[model samples]
Target chain A: MTETPTSSHFKENAHAALHDAPLQKALQHVRVNFIDKRAKAVARLPEFEALRDSARDIKDHTLANLDLYIEAYEARVVAAGGHVHYAMTAKDGVDIVLKLCHERGAKAVTKGKSMIAEEMGLNAALEAAGIDPIETDLGEYIIQLRGEAPSHIIAPAVHLNKEQVEADFRRVHRDLPSDRDLSQPVQLLTEARGILRDKFLSADIGVTGANFLIAETGTSIIVTNEGNGDLTQILPKVHIVLASLEKIVPTLEDASQLLRVLARSATGQDMSVYTTLSTGPRRPGDPDGPEEYHVILIDNGRSSMLGGDFEDMLRCIRCGACMNHCPIYHAVGGHAYGSVYPGPMGAVLTPSLIGVEEGGQLPNASTFCGRCEAVCPVRIPLPNMMRHWREREFERHLSPKAMRYGIGFWAFFAKRPTLYRLSTNVAMRALHWLGRAKGRFASLPFAGGWTRYRDLPAPQGATFQSQWRAKSGSVH
Target chain B: MSAREEILANIRRSLGVTGAEAPRRMAVDDRLAQARSGIIPQRGQGDQAARVATFKDEAERAQASVVEVETAADAPGEIARFLRDSNLPATLRMGDDPRLAAMPWSATALDTAHGASDGHDLNAVSAAFAAIAESGTLALVSGPDNPTTLNFLPDNHFVVVAASDIVGDYESVWRKLRGGYGKGAMPRTVNFITGPSRSADIEQTLLLGAHGPRRLHIVIVKGA
Candidate 1:
């Protein structure tokens, strides 16, 4: 069913992704783009690294007293004349939104890009309940039209080319004259803008995600470059902010601290174009704003992640920087991970939210290059958390049989240094002689997983220990 | 248990807390009460002239057009000149900001309307509550005085701020906000707008004007 939900088939998904021609072409844009831009932006701000530490400490302090802060945050929200709902599960989150829509008799709802909505599968739920939910983010709108999951957290349709988007626009907007020029990305954006403008004006309910929930003033802040989140929230009669629990910050200043690093690490902008801090609803005498405001604080297993090995993940601002810097993500793209999130952050977080059984393979897919941790705004030790997940997977016997037995066999020799050295030395000598002609192995028994896509360089008849000893334990 | 109670209870259970710890409550209360502004960069710290220079420089870097005038009276003529030079319509929409209402709009042959934008305006202008020099951000608080829609719904947006209102960092803006709205309170909406709207979602090719203003023009009045 649905091809076994690709996360469980991560290896196969990655294999298929490697062979995908168009996706490969589309992924080339990501490799040379975000890395250079983020480096440039981070270079301009000398205090960027220090700001990252401050951001990290802010999240750490808030999370340590998360219960009390949440209580205080809720109190401020109520005092500001807004309503806050807590959803312990994803279904409860969806049900809460559905109830709001039903109460409002909503015929149409406009939405900003929100990973939490993706987690709750809120769009499908609303559609099943006979309410139309329209995605307003240009990237999200494209993926939504194709009925596909997002490939990247920030750039949701990053795995698509201009040609593919043109085709999608042609198929969906059949009423548009076939002769009209849709040759460029800007034209597609313009067409979407014209169509969504009416949707924004007429929608009965609007749902958006909060970049941060400021506890001091009971504010839900949204940072966007397109200004779509503002249009989605302000035009409608009702505005709903769907945020996970750990998005809370103690004060406006903490939000500001995180904002400095968030945009820099995510999109390389000193500031996103629009950072709207909305508190409560429209006040009396205020013109052109939502009348009712609601915030659904969804836990969905995040509360359970607190005080665990994966607790550092709670500090994630969802800046998508970890994925941007991940090498494995560069290879396979986000859809291959097939979780709500992808890349290094997903590798550790998916198993925590869903389960180790369903999402265990994601953590194994990493090369552990540590790029994700290096670029994280809050400095999440992503590789360390993935190692913990690997331990959990191994303890549960969820890893492959060859891996279990192979590590076990290696451990037996590893425990005895003499035997380990003897076996490795003999094996190296045999392989060096066999591969002396080509100086490499194109294929080998029990190494298909490696050599299938890349070649392996041969050793030169010496174990690493011997080379280290000969070189006096120094390496260039 | 209610969803709120159960969720909070689970968070307490996971952290091995009873939700009644005095030290935890005190820490949260103190942090909220005395909001600490951390790591304001040196780039934005300066005197009035330096602050204006940085604000103009950073605003231009973010692709916003900035112009300085001698007085609040000179802003209207400059705006009219800018619209004419850009070959835009000589019409503008604005909010009930008294500073803008007092501008000598009749000095130029421009037609301006007052009130919120209903998503059908070509250009709109609003007075900033304050401006930040760090990233050239204009803080617009929502009220009858200035609707938030005017900041986002226009094709071209013009914001007028006094030079003295320019702050060094967002922390200074927060201080001004607390001074205006009191502690633990805020207006319905506060938008920190850096530039015109943009999106790189389409194949990561950056395009200006996805849904908000395609162009943002800031007029800094020196002697207001």
Candidate 2:
């Protein structure tokens, strides 16, 4: 269940991301593209906010009754002739998938874009077991060939430009002519389509992540615009659905309520090109689809998140809206966070999934701007959760010595009003007199982190308490 | 403890409840049985003619071609015409759908094959279980009647949806499915396809025909 977390070195990753020229160029697109499209989509639907509230309520209800719902869901799946496996950890999930693949003698496995798979590190496990795993989503395919993790949740290759993709394709797709008309985005999509279509046909097993798993009918739903997920499930002999425990909803109508906001928040589409609800393996008379269906329900610390301060984070639908509207994500891209999930959602969730000790630095990577909470389709209180993680980090002594000492120093003064006022007033007067000529400080003693980037404004001579005390009731 | 039992035990522990809690079980059962529609958007609600108009408009907006025929018998001709107009091959593959089999294919000089796709056909046609006005989606169920492959494997997909089957929202389709497949049961697959296959993965530039039908032609059977 435990993987090495690079989140402890977030500062270095963020610094490197800031200086990466091509990556900075690629990160600019997220700022330009998703904001207006989502705004326009929201503007078109007047019931969007109300629907978001409804979606939130549904998820809350499901989580509160998750154990019962899981029992109901498993019963329904078995009745439909599909198998259900409960995986207590990431390794358990990998082992279940490997055993299934080994039973089928599956040489090649095609995969839809599943962040759960990424979180479990499933591809590496499959390769270790000697089965080839092929990513079928165009974005996942690009990142797989380049041997990197997804930078963004919905768009895996968001940190790369077209030239970089063209180079990767040219390097890997050596069977094609070196100088075919590969300049346009459509040309690149066409090449991936042609290549992946063969893998889809021949792969013996398929794996996908569920957008929603309906307990009412034992159905697993996947929504995609590219239709790769449908092909991955339909064209194989075995279909294995990888889902976390919180994905279960009660009924089709409940799933519909969430779907109303999902595509609109993710890519600003009214509905994706394909929204498939698959119940089980092929029916008796069915001419197409897989012969076996299995759903792997993974806990991996999510059950512990229930009824905790971070419980709200489980309401996430992975819409990518929080990241799309995130200022920090736009500045540094997703790789800077150094987690499978990134941006504001990752900041709150990474600590819950992985411990606060290793993931303590992630929640501190935010500006607390509130845009993530505002744009979230499920209205997860992301900033508040990050604040909770910060409190836990402080309580657990995971914060650095300098930060703890700085806060201790401030707390000492905060306990005594008169002493705090005297010290601040004297220091403000001294700084004002010293920097009045320049009106800003290019460098300040013991404050190089701030002064290194930009100038700090000269302090006012009077403290806020003194000014307020003198001007009380007169200005108004 | 088994993984399943242990996981459930941990969830119950964290949630502060036993699995035998009556009210919780009742809540889950009630929600599933009721299957209530939460919030239906107002954009697609209207009378029949207005609903049909909105359906066609939304389908076209999603980049699918919409054509109306007088009856089910005339659907083949329109599909054949669509193939001719698009400069695609004059051949189509389909399943053993009774509605499609009953069509008068002799009315057009087009070649047709039967039973699910093996990824070689250029054109295929199927009968939609229902058509949604809101979001312009077509609901297709998997069976011997309309194999799932016919919907995705072909380059050009022609769907024959009866005019009377168009609904105002997705909830209505759910009601229809419940009536057909019984409560708490579903077909092997229920596909809600809004448009032809597409992807914006490449630098967020929208491109059609990414591993599914490039063209979706809907032949609405009016007054059938």
TM-score of each: 0.97, 0.98
As a whole number from 0 to 100, the lDDT of residue B11 in candidate 1 is: 93
Query: In candidate 1, what are the lDDT values of residues A351-382, reduced to their tens digit?
Result: 99879999999999888899999999999999
Local error of candidate 2 at A32, Å? 1.8
**Cα-lDDT of candidate 1:** 0.92
Which residue pairs does candidate 1 place in steric collision? none
Q: Give the poorly placed runs of model 1, Cα more than 4 Å off.
A: A1-4, A436-442, A451-458, A467-476
Give the alpha carbon lDDT tens digit for every residue of A323-435 in model 2: 99998899889988888899999999998888898889999988999999999999999999999999999999999999999999999999999899999999999999999
Instruction: Write out the backbone clash pairs for model 2.
Output: none
Q: Candidate 1 chain B: minimum summed lDDT over ten consecutive residues — where?
A: B20-29
Candidate 2 per-residue lDDT, tens place, B78-141, comes to 9888888878778988888899899998789889899989988999999999999988999999
TM-score of chain A of each: 0.96, 0.98
Q: For residue A76, give model 1's deviation from the true position in Å.
A: 1.1
Q: Considering only chain B, report the TM-score of model 2.
A: 0.98
Question: lDDT tens string, model 1, B166-205?
Answer: 9999999889989999999999999999988999988899
